[model samples]
Target: MRIKVLALSLIGCCSAMAWAQQKEPTKPAETEVYEPVPPKVRVNEKGIPSDAIVLFDGSNLDAWMSGRDGDAAQWTLNADGSMTVKDKAGDIRTRQEFGSVQLHIEWKSPAEVQRKGQNRGNSGIFLQDRYEVQVLDNNNNDTYVNGQVGSIYKQAIPLAMASKPSGEWNTYDIIYHAPVFGKLGEVIQKGSLTVIHNGVLIQDHFELLGTTEYIGWPKNKPHGKGAIRLQDHRDNSRVSYRNIWVRELE
Candidate 1:
């Protein structure tokens, strides 16, 4: 029994020595993996990398041509670097084409508060000249739910109502994926959009139903490349737009 106990103590000492020799997990070689500098992002609050093209940066509107006859834009340039709708000068659009885009636009209704509903600072940012993600002054005012601020205009209502009072600047950072179709004009991959209205997410990867309209249901028009149009509703709402930029996607 004495010999057995002596052997057991020896074994325990050997095991403890072996364990002590083992270096405790020295904080795994903290090799700093410095990532490469990301690309220029137009509107990526999520820190995603992107390439962008600046349209209007309080500099010039040369990137945009008239929606009427391809001449210079007719909108009046505000002293604050914003461009106001010519009221009856029709709409303006970029001269380029885009498939998927990260769009950032800043706008505001005239301080001189206007009429109510549909006519209250009514305007639109028409993507691909077809899909209209609406822009309206819905502060304490009501209108058609699906056609109000941050709407996919007549298709899907916003996930929330986030509109600043009139005159204050409101912003929209939109990620838009253009539609994809099969041979039979049937939608294969429907377009999706996520909109941030005034730093609030109002549209979250919402599927588009088709082009926006006033008096009818959504329709799937054939796809190709199209311009970005700003609607001039002919209501003299004095819509202003600034900080316009875009980043194309493959």
Candidate 2:
């Protein structure tokens, strides 16, 4: 019995010693990844990337058409390098269709605050011509949170209100992922959007449920690539836009 106890104690001591001598986990090795810089045209001195498609460079409206019936875009193109909304001209959309894309656009509300609430310099940028990223004069202006500037229309509220004062330009840098549909027109993977408004992160990789609607619940309608639509509002808001560009993604 004495020998057995001594043997057990020794075994326990050896095990404890082994455990104490064990080393901690080694850290993973660091490796560098190679990412080549792409070429860019840098038009309008906007620093637009080389792989981007210039939609409007403050020159003309050749890349756009009327969203109502595919007619030519009739918005007033100013010599000041911006396009002003000609009320009653109907919504304008890009003639070229795109799927997933990284889009950059700059807009400014009229210097004069015309109307209040939903009618205050209201406009929108519709991805796939369906999902809306609302544009409004929310600076010192109050409205529904989900329908305010930088919101996804009435669907998703912005994380922050990032709108400049009236007449000041605000930039929207959006990265959109198109939804994938199955064979039977069912959504296999939902789309997502990441929006940076005026250099502020508002929508942080928001998952789009479906098409943005103002009257009813959002619905998923299977559709292919579509043009980027700009709402006219038709209320004489006089919103101006310039320096629009997009980069298609795979």
Candidate 3:
């Protein structure tokens, strides 16, 4: 099945090239740069590619509605187009729901050192607002290996700590699969996650034990398509995010 999918993707790419070539020879030429984009890096290309939705590009968060009241994102947008957490405004989730999504999120911790460890810089990008892939400054600081940087919250520990220092931006490139529940509320297909933290493979083919937590074990409850959420830990962490985008997979 995987090989078939790969073949289909290659065929699609070739067909796209052919279509471009047949349309208007006077148009500008297309080039393959052979560049590998690291995690959380933004792609500035235009138009939809298959099943996807662009959330942010340092332009506006109008694509986001308040997870609290279905209003526009109230976070502070900087001159550079990044969005900062609004202290106590809680989290902001996408108004449009998603099932299986490829999420791209880039975040930066505080540069000035006031606290240490988790208190220093902590935040998360929540898929479906339930399962959380952690975000913290795990560069060299010591903390719980599982819950520190790139673990699936508290359930599964990361393969390695791939984090930059506080203040430097880090990225999380995640491909998330939502759980499939039956009529009796039994999960037939437990969700799975693949995360690349800061250009490093941390959680490769990790099965989610349950929803991420700070005080308890994971619990797998039945769910469906849900909104993507950015956490608000209610500290002075001053976490910033940009280049937020997603591609829904069927």
RMSD of each: 13.7, 11.9, 10.1
Q: What would the per-residue lDDT of candidate 3 be over residues 1-250, giving only the tens digit for each residue?
A: 3443344345445676665564333433232222344335344454334345778888888888787888878888999878988887878998888898888888988787656777767778889889988877665567877778887887788887777777877888899988888999988888899999878988887877778878877777788788898877788667899878798776
Least well predicted 10-residue stretch by lDDT in candidate 1: 28-37
lDDT of 1: 0.84
Give the runs in model 3 whose Cα sits over 4 Å from its true position. 1-51
Q: What does candidate 1's lDDT look like per residue over 126-229, in tens digits?
A: 88989999988888789989999999999889989988878989989999999998899889988988999989999999998888878798889779778988
How accurate locally is residue 7 in candidate 2, as Cα lDDT from 0 to 100?
44
The Cα error of candidate 2 at residue 178, in Å, is 0.5
Off by over 4 Å in 2: 1-45
**Number of the top-ranking candidate, with lDDT as the measure:** 2
Clashing pairs in 1: none
| 1 against 3, candidate with superior lDDT | 1
TM-score winner among the candidates? 2
lDDT at 120, model 3: 61
Write one digit per residue (lDDT tens) for candidate 2, span 47-127. 888778999998789999999899899999999999998999999999999999999999999998888988999999999
